[model samples]
Structure formats: C-alpha cells, structure tokens
Target: MHSDGNRKATIARHRVRLAACALLAAAAVLAGCERGSQIGAGESTGGPSGCPAVLAGAQAAVSRAEKKEVFWNGPTTGPAAAPGKTIVYVAQTMTNPGVAGAANGVREAARVIGWNVRVIDGGGTPAGIQAAMSQAVAVRPSGIVVGGFDPDSTSQQVSRADAAGIPLVGWHAVAAPGPSRRPELFTNVTTRVEDVAGISARWIIAHSHGRAGVVVITDASIPFARHKSDLIRKELATCSGVELLAYENIPIPDASSRTPQVIASLLSRFRSRWTHSVAINDLYFADAAAAFRAAGEKGSGPPFNIGAGDGDPSAFQRIDDRLYQAATVPEPLSQQGWQIVDEFNRAFSGRPASGYVAPVHITTAGNSDGATTWDPAGYREAYRRIWGK
Candidate 1:
C-alpha cells in the first residue's frame, strides 16, 4: 500500500509540471505574436511597426521631402528697392551659421539693391542683444533685422525700434514665417516649423523601418526651437514601434562643450538601445561626433543623426562624408536672406508683407550633388527682378 501511494504521488507531480510547461509555452507564443510582423484583421503587429499605415505615410512623406530641385517660390513682384537705405542686421550671434548665412544673403541683396548694410553681433546674450539693439536704434538705420533670435526677448528695444518707426524684419524671429503684430516685426522669414518638424521625424521613421530608439536634442532656451522639438516629438509618437529614449535640452551656445559629455553618459546608459538621434540644430551632432568615435561607434552609425533645422555647410559635409549625421531639413538660407531684404523693401514702401514662405526641403548625401549648401535655384535672379536691380 505504501509503494502504490508513493507511485500515485509521483504521477500527480508529473501532471502539475506538464501543465505549467504548457502554460509557459502558450505565453511564449503570445509574446512572439505581439512582436511579430503579422497583419491581422484591422490590426498590424511587428517589432519594427505596430502601425503599418503610419509607417507607410511617413515613408511617402520622406520620399517627397528628399527630392532635389527646389525652385524659387518667393515673391516675384515687390516694390523696387528704396535706394540709398542703410540697414542694421542685429544678429543673435555671428557664430551661428544660420544667422551668418542669412547675414551674408542680406549683404548680397543689399549690394544688388544699392543699399548700405551693417551687422551688429549680439553675442547671443540678453544684455548684449539689448545693447546691440540700443546701438541699432541710436544709429537710426532705415530698418533693423532681428537675426535668428526672439524679438520678444528684447521688448524694450523692439518697442524703441517700433516707436522710432524702424521697420523690423526677422530671420527666424518668430514661430511662423510672416508678419508678427504683438512683437511688431514686419515679417519673420523661415520655412514652416510644422513642415520641417514633420519631415525630420518622418525621416527617422522611414529610415529605421518604423522602429527606432530616438534621442531628441533641442535648446529649450529659444521658444522657436523648443516648439520645433515639441512638434518633432509629437510626430514621432505616431509610430508605435518608435521609442523616444530621451529628450535632451542643451542650449545652442553650450552645445559644443556639453554635448560630448552628454553623449558619453547616454552611450553608457542606453548603449545599443540608442539607435537614432534628432536635433533641432545640426551643431549638436557635430559636437557629439568625437564622443561617438571615442565610444567606438561606427561613423556609419547605429545612432543615425538628423538635424531638424539650419542645415549649415558643415552639416552637408557631415552627411556627404557619411559621418555621424545622415540627413538635414535645410532652410534655404541664401534665398531667405534675399527675401528679408525684399520684405524690408516692401515695408519701406508701405506695402503688405509678401507672405512668401519657402517650401521645406531635405538634404542627404544621396541627393546633395556634392553641394555644401541647399541654396534653392532662381531666388537671386527673382529677387533682383523684383527689386529692379
């Protein structure tokens, strides 16, 4: 009787083990289904993409933005240049490549329009910018340019310029690309931030096959940039397979010094999980390149980087060389510069703002044609024709 009871007990234990094993096997199958690239009725499942439609949309948008040959779509008819006018371009910093590029465009347009232009470097500080604005107002130029900085930051100076009836045209001075009333800018020149932000995020989605561990870098100090980063984040969220690993806010001025350390810490933390990076500006990747190299990351990267704005010459070079950066949503810097001068001319003539916003374009080594800058075609001649120069 004792032997029979022991045998029965052993059979019971075997039954329990088999049941548990069956349950675990079932669970493993379910988990695999959750991560598998299988399409069910009205549902998509995949490690790379849980929403195949969203991924497809992103891929299509990226393809559209990556096309070359953006033609001049700016103002073809505007007031002829008010001759012999002197303008002061008060820049946030000459060190900012976008600001400097626009400044150069302004210089070139001024030459064409037979005007004198002077630039004051604000040195990217509040007090310094205020001082520069004060000097700008004191000199009483025909117009003042709020170059690559917020006009509201210098409200007093802006008010002074407004009171003095100095027309203020801005290059990325406000969120949108047209006249600003409260801040009293004649117009703000930039590609629509929504378009830029959308395309940049879509690039990551398409490139990664809808699955990416992304880190976003932005300067929260500037409202425009902060807004841009927010839009990028929102767009990226549409893809369920994409995981935003981190949102990093390093000021543009501090990027060079801080980005390397930040990259090192992030490398240690995320390691292989960190597969892509999107920056509001291209400079962050430029700063992070050496750190990535030190970490033994390939130049052709797992952490593929794309800049949302300000596709400077260096950014193009990085992309062309297949360095740490993969692509950029470039603002047509030279064309916008010419537009600024044209806008100022219209303001001088008491006409309405042109309302011409340049279409957004993306640049990669594949389509850059060995170009350092994404200078759109026909803007120079178009602006000259408008100014009757």
Candidate 2:
C-alpha cells in the first residue's frame, strides 16, 4: 500500500509540471501577438507586419491609459474627427522644404477626405513651437501636426488638445523622454530615425572596408539626438571595420561664434587619432567634414570617410563632390505626411488601419546618377483619394 501511494504522488507531480509547461508556451505566443507595428496610410489597416514602431517608449504608456477617461484643457468633442465634420491640420513650421512637403501631403489628404488642415511655424525653438501649439489650441482645429516641437513644451498643448477631445498627431522627432503629468501623445505619424540611422551606419562600415576607427560627432542637445545616435552606435558594432573612438555632443547656443570654432576643434581631434567622422546632419556635421579633409594626413583611407544625415540636396551635392562620404536621404516628406492623415480618417471611419513600411533605400554610387524619387504618382493618387477636391 505504501509503495502504491508513493507512485501516485510522483505521477501527480509529473502532470503538474506538464501543465506548467503548456501555460508558458501559450504565453509566449500571446507576447508575439502583442508586439505590433505602426498604423500607417495605405493597404491593410493596423496589422502587425506593416506598422512602424514610432514614439514607442512613450506611446506604450498610452495603452495603459484609461480608454474612457478624458482630460481638462480643450473641448469635450472631437466632432472635427467625427464623420462628416471637416478636419484641419496646422503645422508649426513649413519653412524647410521637408516641412512644406509634409504640409503639402497633409493638405492634399484633407482635400480628398473633405477634412481640414492649418499650419503655423514654431521656428524650431521651445518658445516658437509652444506659440504654434497655443495658436493651434485657440483655432480649435480638428487635428494637429507637430512640425518641430519638443514634447516637454508640447505636453501642455497636447493636454489641452486631449481635453478638448482632439487627437494630436506627431511628425519627425519628439521632445525625448521626460516626466510629464499628461498622457503620452498620439502622433499618428513621426519620422523613422533609427531606420535612417541604421542605413547610414551600414554605409559607413561597408565603405571603410569593415575595419576602421571613427569619431562620432553626435548632437545630444536635441531631444531625439541621443536615441538616434545610440542606435547608430549599436548598428555600427555589427559592421567589420568600425569602432567609435569618441562621441562628443556640441551645444552651441550661438551658431555665430561656436559653429566654426566647435567644428575646428573636432577636426583637430580627429586629425590626430581616428580617420573617420559621422554627424547628425549636413550643415552641422558638414563643418566637421570640411575640417577633417583639410587636416587629414594626405592619402589616409579615402580621406577619412565622413557622413551625415538628411537626404537634402546639399548633402547629395557633397556626396557627389566626394567631400562627404554619404548621407541618408529621408525624402518626400509629403508622401509619409499625407499617409498618416489617411490613417486618422481610416480609424475614425472604422476602416482597418492601412499600414506601410517604406523601403529604407540607400543612396549610393549605384543610384547616384538616377533620379531618385521617394514618392511617385501612386502616392499622389492615394493622397487625392484620402483628401480629394
């Protein structure tokens, strides 16, 4: 009898272990389902594959927010986003071609869907962006486009919009990670900094023969600067001939006095130890590229490979002239900008969220001569259908 009792207890324990294993397996499957993508413009709406993870760390908190809860700043009704009501978008800064392209995309979308859009320039400053948000609040627009505003300052404006039952969409970068008493933003759209950064890093590694040391002149002052730069560093590690010797962030409030001086110092340092440089953009990092070329010991590894961000024509010109090695082309802001507008309409209309992961194409010697267009006729048609005449 004793032997039989012991055997039964062992059998029961084995059954319990098997059940635990099954539960763990089920949880693993659920986790994969939860890891979703960005809700984009065209095609299927809100599917996992096509979504781009934008404003992830911050936006994650929104899911934990009370779905039925409302705030106390703006309106209680988002009739602008409601069916048959016009939706208006206001951009804080449409000065740069990139920004204007974004506005153009948004406006075109509004026209198709019979929505509305309004834009104001925040001048790319804290006060400037804040004022733009303020004006947007006063206009009581249907929706908002954060042209170049920081989150810390934009948070209050977002609160005001949220309270009024308006959905705020973000474009490009946010104000980095900070503690705010407000809910995380709901930017139907934002830039893909990491995607572009990875492309840029891969370019650097491939060009440098897989083994080289370089200086990273990243701009840390900008809220999203560290995030992009950090990703670049990680990707670079995977490349063969790349080592980030040192990274220095320049905070020059005075562009007049410090710009040249700062670049000059960076050049001096790179001249001594490393043979490469990577910067965040054309103008700022262009200064360093010029310095390194001038100071580089003659005939040292393809003139010390230097690259920057932005697909702007100026960066292309430098790449052509071979003054700069390469720069990522984040082009046709109009295409993606309008795509996000389409997203809001789809959600409000109860249509599936169309998703897209634009190809992260590289602009290199292979495609240098060819006319590279980021968005095409199909893009225009999509915009027209969403916000038509």
Best by TM-score: 1
TM per prediction: 0.88, 0.64
lDDT scores in order: 0.86, 0.52
Residues 1-389, candidate 2, lDDT per residue (tens digit)? 99999999999999999999999878764552231211111112112311122223212322222122222221112212334544445454444445556677777766666666666766656687777778888887666666544455677887787788765555554632111233444443544666656655655554444444566655565655567678778876764335687776754233324555665675455533354556654444444454545554232233344343445555555555555454344444556666667656654655544534343444543345633334423665544534432
* lDDT minimum window of 10 residues, candidate 2: 37-46
Candidate 1 segments whose C-alpha is farther than 4 A from its true place: 1-48
Candidate 2 Cα deviation (angstroms), residue 264? 1.6
Clashes of 2: 36
TM-score of predicted model 2?
A: 0.64
- Steric overlap count per candidate: 0, 36
Location of the lowest summed lDDT over 10 successive residues in candidate 1: 35-44
lDDT of 2 at 325: 50
